[model samples]
Target: MQDTTMAGLWALGLGTVKAQSTVTKTMNASIPTLVVLANLPQLALSVIYVLVNRLLSAMAAAREWASFAHSRKGLRVTVPQGQQRSTLWLQLPYSFAIPQLVLSALLHYFVSQSLFLAQIAIFNARDETEDGGASVSSIGFSAIAIFCSLLTTGAVLVAVVLAGLVVRSEAEDGT
Candidate 1:
């Protein structure tokens, strides 16, 4: 199952690279470098997420077991009183991270586009052109940056969505 998840991640990476490659005929090899730079932080976040989630899940399981044990011993089980306690270890910045992921994506896109446009302006600064219709200044999208940013934003979004689902499942199971 872990292998499957890793494989899916790799596929997602490849797909994003391939999708962005459609924009220009620049160096295709640059994709990997940008991807690595952009994803390093997210990789750390992913590891933290998995570790903390496992810890919380174990605690929840232990609490459930203890309650069951007490009930089997003919003692009444006290409902796990703290609603916030259930999520203590695994609380994500849902209010912030969700919108942050989305906004970061859009911002990254614009930044990348601006860089590409700047590059175009630089190339055209000498008034050089292939078809003579216009200079390279018209290019408006930095393909690599956009791709990398999207990759990162995508990872965060997936994590957030999965976190929401797990929280919901845990709640439902407890009830």
Candidate 2:
């Protein structure tokens, strides 16, 4: 999991570099380095969110597994207020989850759109005469854009499910 997160961060950094170069080359303007670096904090925050959530989830799962294993060993396992207590170790951020999810989805959508537009601009800059049609490069970029859009959409849907889980958990807590 840590490896995956690190890889994700690395990929995001690479993508930022590519995006910066593409935008500069296509738009024929000098994009400030800060423009690329500004997104790093948000990306880092996303990574932190993933890490913390996964870590908490793993802890909860480990607790459950250990309890089951102990029970199987013929030892009496005492659960504290097992009926009322939550098995989950980490509480979901009820108030901020939806907003964060929406922001993340929007960020992804805008970034993908920006990339798509940059590709189109590059195509136009290369072939000034051709118009109103798709070239191979444009098509390729379009496919990537579509994939990014779909990925973000899927993430948003997952957030919706997580939001539901948070609400259900709160209800279970009789809050």
Candidate 3:
């Protein structure tokens, strides 16, 4: 429970930093319009993923700790070398839930940053410089990038939902 709490807090702090960085970069960019528009999809996706992930994390943590309290008499601080067994099923919430949430948060941040950068590149490519910039061939790259990121975020969201379902089933079974 302590570990999961710490991980969740760390994810929250890291996500805030990343969001601020994204906003700062977008504000300072030469193509504010393009950057802002490009960020819209990612921003919506981030909000959805963040909310769902946080809820899953909290629910899993609560259930796991409740199970622990119920089995307190059988609980031990550490498993012996030859007897690596215990009543606590720590892997589900600790290994899967918290890490996935953190990964989603981190991935969302980087993908959003990449989207902003790609838009800036595309906007710059349209300039009338002597050396010239990217041709029309690269114009669709930003859209493709945004689409790919959205797809990946959707897949992760599905996985988180599945984890929540597993937690719910386990609770029902009294496991």
Candidate 4:
């Protein structure tokens, strides 16, 4: 759920930028600034991925602790031995980790596709034009980018729903 919220917040920020660009049509910014702006989504998504991964690890630990507390086997160690030692990444089953990794990749790809800075030269129609033309630059959004972003969000939502179902099933089965 936290991961979903993070994705939603990112989507909201993208939508806000799109709306602003649509209304203004142009934004004055330096090349360096545009470059930084273009990469911001990637940075934000990376942070989100780390936070979500940690959240999943914590959830797995809690689930394991609950099971151990209730088990009739008592204080037997749950941690795996040898090279398959317990760690943050090892806490989650591959079933959960793989989808999360795929979704994170998709999120990064879709976000990179969705927004970018574009510079276009504009010519003046007036005869009294001094410089004859000027360049306008702004962030641009594409329909396909919007579609990709929404698809990624939907995929994340579906993953969350599936995880919930798995947890519920495990509880019912006492496993």
Best by lDDT: 4
Model 4 over residues 1-175: C-alpha lDDT tens digits?
A: 2233555545545534444333133377776787688778889888878877777776665566656545643332358565443444555877779889889888887788677776656555564434665666677654455677788878887877777677656666668
Q: Model 3: per-residue lDDT, tens digit, 68-162? A: 64454333335534434453344344557566756677666656644443322223444653334532111112333334456666777777778
Q: How close is candidate 1 to the true structure, as a TM-score?
A: 0.30
Give the clashing pairs for model 2: none
Q: Write the per-residue lDDT of candidate 1 for residues 1-175, one digit (tens) a residue.
A: 2233544445533323332323344434354454454445446555654664555455455544555533442322234453323333223334434554465555445344423321221225566654555322122233444455566657656755665566556555653
Off by over 4 Å in 3: 1-30, 65-70, 73-93, 101-140, 143-147
Candidates 2 and 3, the one with greater TM-score: 3
lDDT for each candidate structure? 0.45, 0.45, 0.53, 0.66
Q: How many steric overlaps does candidate 4 have?
A: 0
Cα-based TM-score, every candidate:
0.30, 0.29, 0.47, 0.62
Judged by whole-model lDDT over C-alpha atoms, candidate 4 comes out at 0.66
The better-scoring model by TM-score among 1 and 4 is 4
| Poorest 10 consecutive residues by lDDT, candidate 3 | 135-144
Candidate 4 residue pairs that clash: none
